[model samples]
Target: MNICVFCSAADLDARYTTPAREFAELIGKGGHALVWGGSDTGLMKVMADGVETAGGRLVGVSVDFLAHKVRPGVDDMVITKDLAERKAELLARADAIVVMVGGTGTLDEATEILELKKHGLHTKPVVLLNTAGFYDGLKEQFQRMEDEGFLPLPLTELVFFAEDGAGALAYLEEQAGIQG
Candidate 1:
């Protein structure tokens, strides 16, 4: 499977970065490829390094203006004309999506993926790694949306949440029908 991971670009904390690396390593060792933003900083770099270290394939998607930020040594890369195109390419190439600890950009990406799934545009599994309660607020917001009847369906039906990388991978395996 080609897993797309949305994560922070600023390496502000090790709490998030460490888990991101572990997740990436697990993906590589499991013989799964990664589709992610083509940035070399923060969690992106950690993830790319982990995948490369474990001999997993890496497919990066980035805009032309951010070309300099693309990680070196990626197995493949898709350069888009803008952010919208980049997001489309990432979603097109991914079989599943993982939302890691990140900022606004990550939130935007995660929401877009969820929206797509809600609209039946894609059936790919979306997993949120809620490490250290990082996504507690977002989860609450989702609940509020459901309570307000603004969402067509429950958020739980739209995405899955895991406490850690292992849990996330397990959910992915189950959703993707990968045995052991």
Candidate 2:
């Protein structure tokens, strides 16, 4: 499966970085391909490195404007003209998505993917990795949205929550009907 991970571009503390790298390693070890932003910084770089070390295939998507800013050694990349195009490409190429601890950019990607699923645009499984309780507030907001009737309960069910990388991978495998 081609798994897309949305995570922070900023270098966070080891509390978050450690798990992110572990998650990436698990993705590679599980024989899953990775699709992500093409930057070699922060969690993105860690993820790519982990996958590379584990011998997993990688596909990076970057915007044309940031072509000069992308990592140098990416073998497979899809360059888009803009952010919108990049997002589309990411979603289009992913069989599943994992939402990790991140800042606003990560939130934006998560929301966009959720919205797309809510509208019946896609049925891909979306998992949120709640490492160190990083996504507590976001989960609350999602609940509030459902409480306010802004979104239906079933729509909110489209998003899955896991406490760690292993849990996320198990959920994906189950969803894909891949027997262990």
Candidate 3:
């Protein structure tokens, strides 16, 4: 199954990034083909590159705005128009969503995917790659949605957490039930 990995392009900064390489390698080794927004550097590229090196297929959905900005030597690229178009294209192609810790764009995209799940536009499972407790606040906000009577109990099951790459890949297999 195609797994959509949403992460920031800003993670190239050492101060802002975490050891998500473990996650990348785990997913790659698990044989889950990657479907992600195209960015040659940063955490996104880190994951894709690791996957490709590990003999995994990493499919990049490149938007017009980010195409020129993409890192050189990406294995596969499909260019689109803009951010919204890019996300749409990615979603169209993915069967699941794995959200890694990231900045505002990542958060916005995660929320948008959640919204799609809420509306039943897609029933694709979503997981959070929670490195070093980065997503505590966001999880709290999801809890608030339940407290405010907007969200439901099953949603807690919808977005599971994996502390590292291994856990993320394992949970992906558990959630998607696709070994290959």
Candidate 4:
């Protein structure tokens, strides 16, 4: 199954070190591939670089606005005029969503996947590699969704939690069946 590896563009932040490389290596060695925003730098690029080194298949999707800013040299470029188009393409091709710790950009990527699942546009499993509870606030929001009855308990199970890259890809393969 195709995996959309989502994360922040924060190259300067010290936090990008762990999740970036870990997620990339996970996707690469897990016998799966990567579909993510293309950038040559930052967490986004870090993951992509690992994917490349591991020789996994890669498909990078980025909006034109971000095209110049994206991680460079993506194997397959899925460029769009805007974010909406980029996201639509990503959703169309992805079978799973792996969210690494990121900033607002990463948050939006994960939330969009959640929304897609909510509306039944897709049922892809979304794995959030928390990496030191960076997503604690987002987890609370998901809880709020359950509390308000917007999401049922079992349905809430669609979102998987992991603390490191190894755990993330293992759960992804087990739950998503992405050996190919």
Clash count list over all predictions:
0, 0, 2, 5
Shift of residue 2 alpha carbon in model 3, Å? 1.4
Model 3 TM-score on a 0 to 1 scale: 0.89
> How many angstroms is residue 98 displaced in model 3 relative to the true structure, after the best TM-score fit?
0.7
Better of 3 and 4 by lDDT: 3
Question: lDDT of each structure?
Answer: 0.89, 0.88, 0.78, 0.76
Pairs with steric clashes in candidate 1: none
lDDT at residue 116 of model 2 (Cα atoms): 92
Model 3 lowest lDDT segment of ten? 11-20
* Tens-digit lDDT string for candidate 2 (127-179): 99999999888888888887788885464467988999989999999999997
Q: Per-residue alpha-carbon lDDT of model 3 for 1-180, expressed as tens digits?
A: 688999988756543353666666666777768888878778887877777777677888988867786656655678998779888988998988989878998998898988888777888888887777889888888878878888744666557776776777777677676664
- Model 1 misses residue 83 by how many Å? 0.6
The deviation in Å at residue 18 for candidate 1 is 1.5
Model 2 CA deviation exceeding 4 Å by range:
153-156
Which tens-of-lDDT digit does each residue in 1-180 have in candidate 4?
Answer: 578887777664556576567667767776567888876667777777788787777888888877787665656887899887888898888888888877777778778888777777787778888887887777887778777887844444758777787787777677765453
Span of 10 residues, lowest total lDDT, candidate 1:
11-20
Stronger candidate by TM-score (3 vs 4): 3
* Collision pairs in model 2: none
Candidate numbers sorted by lDDT from highest down: 1, 2, 3, 4
Better of 1 and 2 by TM-score: 1
Highest lDDT, which number? 1
Assess every candidate by TM-score: 0.96, 0.95, 0.89, 0.88
lDDT of 1 at 13: 75
